[model samples]
Target: ETVDGPPGARTYRRTLRLPYGIGIAAVDERPGTATGGRGARPGGWLDARLHLTDPRDLTTAVQRLRRLFDLDADPYAVDARLGADLRLAPLVAARPGLRSPGTADPEELAVRALVGRDRAALLVQRYGKALDAPCGTLTHLFPEPAVLAGAEPGGTLGALTAALADGTLRLDPGADRDAATAALRALPGLDDHTVAVIRTRALGDPDVAPPGTGAPDDWRPWRSYALRHLDVAGEPQPRLARAGR
Candidate 1:
């Protein structure tokens, strides 16, 4: 949830589900006044504060937030690499630190990928754990894999959740990307597109070229960012006659 703050500032509040218990996070953001002079770059800053029920979980919570916001990415190096391609040069110049987003909870992202937004919302409403103290419209934590598995949702969702709950498939941050991709493919009713989305976003693989985009070899290790630039430029390449790796 968001509310107006002091002039030019925006404040956001939300409840977080941590390993031990629920926590709350608040962030205040405003434009950087230091960047207003002639030839100064346009930029802003934010102050993020977290309240945890268990102080021992502080490290884990901070690490999760880093992944959620892609803060560990080395933007300068990524920009240098991707800027070499003329196709992506302009985009790189426009957004120097563009990052491929990572998930705070990989399992949650996988479930959402299997079931689109509408169905996911329904699942959340039905199975999500209510917060001890609700914050604005955010009243519940996303349903856990065990809860969804017990519900025994029909078809692909059921299979996926069961695998996640039982460890047949792992989408955790430390999971091996190739193994996770193979496991996802073995599941019935999961298409290549869905698997690719899971592998790239949920698994945090930065080099994935979705099957058939004809991504060049030069984009290696950074193809995901290149793909985003192509998509934003409305210049997606046609499916290659031979599929891409």
Candidate 2:
């Protein structure tokens, strides 16, 4: 849920499902000014605040927030490496410190990835857990894997949910990236692109270059950020140019 704020700032507030209970997460974002040239700041910064029902969950909440915002990334290093690439050089220069987003809830992201937003909304309406108090339009927590698993959504979604519910697939922040990728690959009906999406966004693997995009090998460990640069620049292909071209 979002609320209009003074001038350029926007405030978004929502209820976050925590291990103990629910917490309110709020963010106030303001777009940065363009100063022009190579060093220009292209994006905005946000201020986040969390109201937790159980203070004991503060550490977990903070960690989740960090992942959600990609705060753990070293943008300067990433920029230096990606900016050296002729194909991504201009984009890196334009949007320095740009981050590849990570999910607040891995299971939720996985479900959304498979079902798309519309079907996920329907699932939310039907199975989402109601908050004791709604935060703006955010009245329910995203349905848990156990709940959705029991709902018996058929086909790929059902299989994915069941795996998540029973721990056949682990998407938690601490889960092993390679193992999870293999597990996702083993599931029928999950294409390479979908698995890559889950690995990059849900598991927070920064190096995955989506299947068959022919991403350069040098983009290792930052391929996800490279892909984000292309996405922001609206380039369908990497189209890397020779170094001196």
Q: Over the stretch 1-245, how does candidate 2's per-residue lDDT look in tens digits?
A: 34657766678675678988788888777577667568655555577788887998788877777787788999999999999998899999898998998877889999888889899889989999888877678788889988998896668888899999999999998899999989998888999888998999899988888766778988876999999999988988555455684
Which residue ranges in model 2 land beyond 4 Å of their true spot? Answer: 1-8, 32-45, 239-245
Q: CA shift at 28, candidate 1, in angstroms?
A: 4.7
Q: All candidates' lDDT scores?
A: 0.79, 0.84
After superposition on all C-alphas, the RMSD of every candidate to the true structure, in Å, is 4.0, 5.1
Error of 2 at 184 (Å): 0.8
TM-score of each: 0.85, 0.87
Q: Would you list the clashing residue pairs of candidate 2?
A: none
The parts of candidate 1 lying over 4 Å away from their true place are 1-14, 27-46, 232-238, 241-245
Model 1 C-alpha lDDT per residue in residues 1-245, reported as the tens digit of each score: 24556765677665567888777777665454444778654553356788888987788877766776677877778888889988789988876777787766789889888899888888889999888777777777889898998896668988899999999999878889889999999999999989988888888888888777778888878888778776767876535776469
**Model 1 TM-score relative to the real fold:** 0.85
